[model samples]
Target: MYQTTSKKTPWIFCKDIINHPQKAMAWVWGYISCKHSMMYTLFVYTLLLILVLLYYVNHRESEPNHDETFKAKVQQSFIKFVEENMPKRDQNKETRAVYSMRTMSSNGSLLEDEHAKILKQRAGDIQREYIGFKNKKPFNFHCDKCAVVASSGQLLHSNSGQEIDNATCVIRMNNAPTIHYEKDVGARTDIRLVCFRSIDFMNKDTLMIGKARFDKMVIWGMENPKHKKIKETFTSKFIRKYPGVDYYSLSNSGEKKATRLYEEYLGMDRLKSNSWLSTGWFTMLFAVNMCDSITVYGLPDGNQCSAGSKKSILYHYYEKRYDECWMYNQHETRMKTGHRYLTEKAVFKQWAQMFNISFKAPAWNLTNVNASEPIKSPFISKMEKIGKKRTKR
Candidate 1:
């Protein structure tokens, strides 16, 4: 009986409410007003959620970054941190990253010597004339005025062609075409940096076409021990065999600071693992080593990936990139594979502060005080003087 009464209590209350007509009318009015207010509040929250969703979806392209100065400052700090510890400064020859020599496993590196040798020997004899990399110290080459040209669509109308040409050496990444893009990217490609994975598909015919142009071809990703076929094929079968082509492989030998920068700043997770750094970063690294006065062209300035009303271009010229660098979530994978370009720029800014480096991006305003040139190397300055005299003569 008690249980039954508990269940009927709500009904008794309703009956009581119904019997008192005036009170019931007042209660109904209060309920109506309260319910209307609650629904209105709920409707406002739903609208806000929709707006947030819209912002999240299109934030990459629609926003225009106005705080380039602040961005530059932040990037400079990254540069300082990376510079204090990078490029692997081991004193022992066997331990350091050998930029001056061919990356053969037989060369007796303390780390990769055994695996590389085994792969090379297993490759056996191939039908090629010039099979070995020139042991003569990175083409016995150095340039005072070098330009590392990135394939950002920002280069499309940058009018940096002349500036690129003016450099003693111009380093380009992948098949960044210069035929039609000569006006924008310049026709002079002194060095072309290709990742080893992409070169495996190229036939002798394709390589022969490029042979007529690019002076020195540097193949990266040779350091990845997983891709043994790329190393074997490049060294043993197809690449070095090409006559008049000086092909060398670059290994991924980074220091702890750089690794931390990738993990902490660039969002790369595994700090100690051997992963493929972007060709752009390594390309810039190579340029800094050889060139006295280095100018980087077409890389996205601080504006591309900035939040809250910032604008950016997807490509340097008209590149067909498989990496979804134009999107936000792609930044998630960048920490793993080293494709987080905007984040990597932090390191580049720090690197520029170390040597004779200058940046030439699309949106560089005259007011940016960080846009100053470093001192030129005496050797490079002399080379530039000689080049100028030759032109005048």
Candidate 2:
């Protein structure tokens, strides 16, 4: 009886609960809470570690190693190649002839009384404009850098006017009429070089070409006597207003001297007889004479429709394309002359590289021909700023 009472006692019951039931439940709850806290801490630590690794990688990539030896070697090699391959200016009789031809072609009748009078007047104006700039202590022409810009019809779409304007002096050639005056021509051009064969070809704002018309209706009213007089009057007023501007006259007479000047000095030759004037010759001659750094934009890459193309008959940009009727005996003429035309444009490119003068074509596609590296213009900086702002948005 005493033993049975001990088993049901309150003390016995308390001991059992402490040893097993309530104690075991408390221990399990404490262990589970600690495990959960440790797991959460580990997860957050791993996430922070991954983020730091990504940041470090990105920062490393952003840095440029300007001191890299490979880059220096490449630049040295390029400079050496250019120095070796380029043609140095020849101080010989051939060079003399080249210069005389270029001067005579651009400035008409070197010994003529009218030519002398015009040159004397222009010389005085040039002196007056440059005198102040030359009198400074350092005697530097401040921003005398000149740029020649050529359009190969490819620049019709690219907005390159702002870049062109950055030049102190800009030279253009032929019938390069820009539809956007303020943005394209007016903004950039400090000087307009026109190769007018006749006074009749001159228009007030642009050089008018008779063959450029697509249809009869386009040039229908241009033939009128009143139109001609109005054009002449407008041109006279425009020139009078801009007296500082110079005008160059080329002969339409198609002489051999002109052809030689076009070929030897200017680096252009006829692909076929009776073809149009070479646009390449015009740009090269002007660049060599007037500008230090030349950037040609719109000139053909020799693959596309150039000034020498057969379709030039429709547009007398230089002159009429050779006519079949003009060739009397095809076999005899062909056999004798062979191909007088320049078949490769690499010759011009070679000359450009040799001079250490930068030549670039911005609108040319690199898919077909080996591409040239474009020199970064000031305009690119402005564009990059715009691009960054856009990316942020």
Best by TM-score: 1
98-200 per-residue lDDT for model 1 (tens digits): 3211122123442234432332232111101112267534333578898888877778777888889988888888766677777788878787777676675
Q: State the C-alpha lDDT per candidate.
A: 0.52, 0.38
For 6-30, candidate 2 gives per-residue lDDT tens digits of: 2223345335534664463453444
Query: Which portions of model 1 show Cα errors greater than 4 Å?
Result: 1-132, 136-140, 201-212, 251-276, 307-312, 320-329, 332-338, 363-393
Ten residues in sequence with the least summed lDDT for candidate 1: 122-131
Rate residue 48 of model 2 by lDDT: 45
What are the TM-scores, per candidate, against the unseen true structure?
A: 0.51, 0.36
CA displacement after TM-score superposition, residue 58 of candidate 1 (Å): 32
- Residue 159 Cα positional deviation in candidate 1, in Å, after optimal superposition: 2.1
lDDT at residue 376 of model 2 (Cα atoms): 24
Best by lDDT: 1
Error of 1 at 199 (Å): 1.7
